[model samples]
Target: MYGGADGAVAVLSVAEEQKHLLAYAPLVKRIVRQLNSQVAGAIDRDDMEQIGLMGLLEALRRYGEPDAAFGSFASLRVRGAILDELRRQDWRPRAVRQESHRLRDSVRALTRKLGREPAEKEIIAALGITAEAYQEYQLAENAEQIGSFDELLQEGMGQADSAPSPEEQLMVRRSLEQALRGLDEREQRVVQMYYEFELSYKEIAAVLDLTDARVCQLNKGALGKMKATLQSA
Candidate 1:
């Protein structure tokens, strides 16, 4: 449909865009690697990398120079795209979802009855589960909740329709800061390093002299508490 000069310009434009995408390839890989650490074994790294590449392409199409730095913006887009894919997969078993709901309901009921957060033993006794079973439930619930929180963060980062206005964003930041204060020193530090400092789990573990799994546990607990606080606020 184009004349010779117009066709040549279109070809050159496509070539330039391809070159830009190639330039950002390493960034995509890094993001995939970082997110893959958290969800290892849940999804294949190669698949996640493919999702990240799609994200990078989306970023290239939508990004404007006056926005944030390209690397940071692109990273957020990549992470969001990967997380969106995970959400689409809905890999959690239906039974697991039902159990998580029951556990949440029990917690809410116990809190209402006691007028405070129930202790671990109290919850276990209320649920009529052995300590070992309760621990398993906690671990599963933590993983599920952390996944939800990650989705929340990803949505906040990338979705324009879901994004908060500046005033609302400031309010959320303040509320989150207040909620973080409710955590112990170590929990607060773990959250700050992981989210604010953008440190990987292993990196955070090394800095805090803890194992990777321990860091994950702490992060899960912190997010649970933060979510509760934010919801109450």
Candidate 2:
């Protein structure tokens, strides 16, 4: 419901609706296949594809049938639907969410005061947290930051759907571009390889000569910095 020409779609006969759904069925499968490859052991591919198909049906109902422009518009809705379900099934407890907020706020405050990103030791001191606790915070931060990166990638693809005007969309694009430009070269390459090139984490690691976990860390750090910059804009 974040956006769509929802309710503005022209009503169609039952036969027409079925035909359109059948036509877009492949798109749902394609999306599920890509997401399933990334999260192989975590979610059932069949279930994800079912959800994606349902999402496509809803998009048809609310945003109308297939058109040249409908694919990108429906793509956003389908992704949102899947991500919403994923969030509902998230394993994080309430306390973890709270701690992430605390860590994020502390880092933001420290950055403002220090006029630079805070070091791990400085952050530990600022938050009066143990090294182990700081590491936990980092894990929490990575989860949230990487989730945000998905939405950011969608925006970059011109698939943003918050009902912005053309001028507003332009500003958002500029802000995101500026934030991306601020990334270090390695971080930039990591992001591009993962998103634009649609490479798996393992594949990106092999190309970058780093471990899979290191690639995730680099991406997390890069997204964190871009998030801060984007918020300021």
Candidate 3:
């Protein structure tokens, strides 16, 4: 029994990389959905899925740090991989791209006009899309678009990096680090996984021995807390 147990451990160790990639497939899908929401063009969900898979593969191949959760690390890789593909597609027609931009503008304008989130119907009407053609046009226009990496990376950097002097920058860094320390361990882990390490919730849950719901709750609560703290500070 001891020998068999040892043999099983060896097998599992060898298969860990494959296991990691398989484990985070669902996370890729969720991220893709998020990307879809942000972009305009024929950016099909399937295309994002494929890109995510490629990213997962790369992450698996390059995975380091056994102490870190695989999902957390792979999230960034998957997102980056998906975006890289979008950037490479130089063959997207000019008219289609233009229309996509216009559609986004329309959506934005309607949102402001209504003082709330606009529905698909409102977007279609604003874009002059016919009922019969709206679905097709929307799908096509969104297929080429995915989430932008720049926005994700720069979200809080502007405020944090605006310090005028080296001493001020150091002070800001220390302050941010101190603020981060006040979060609960789970919140710290979630934030690290999602932003710093780039793990998906699914992956973080697996590594942390928690459910997906709990991971999300902790993340959301942590963000809300952080935002409130920042605002008050």
**Per-model CA lDDT versus the true structure:** 0.69, 0.69, 0.59
Please rank every candidate by lDDT, starting with the best.
Answer: 2, 1, 3
Q: Which ten contiguous residues of candidate 3 have the minimum total lDDT?
A: 1-10
Cα lDDT of model 1 by residue, 23-118, tens digit: 888877776766666654568889888888888776666552213345655666777788788768886678977887898798889999999988
lDDT of 3: 0.59
Compute each candidate's TM-score over C-alphas: 0.62, 0.60, 0.40
Sliding window of 10 residues with minimal summed lDDT for model 1 = 1-10
Candidate RMSDs in Å, in order, are 7.2, 6.2, 12.8
lDDT tens digits, residue span 1-233, model 2: 12344524466678987898888887777666545544433567778877887777777776554655566556656666776776788845789888789778988999999999787789889899887787666655555544466576465544354333345557766887798899999999998886556576667889999756567678887888987897676
Best by TM-score: 1
Candidate 3 residue-wise lDDT, 20-115, digit = tens: 656778878877765554354446788779889888776555543232344544666778787777678754678876876776677778899999
Clashing pairs in 2: none
lDDT of 1 at 73: 54
TM-score of 2: 0.60
Count of backbone clashes, every candidate in sequence = 0, 0, 16
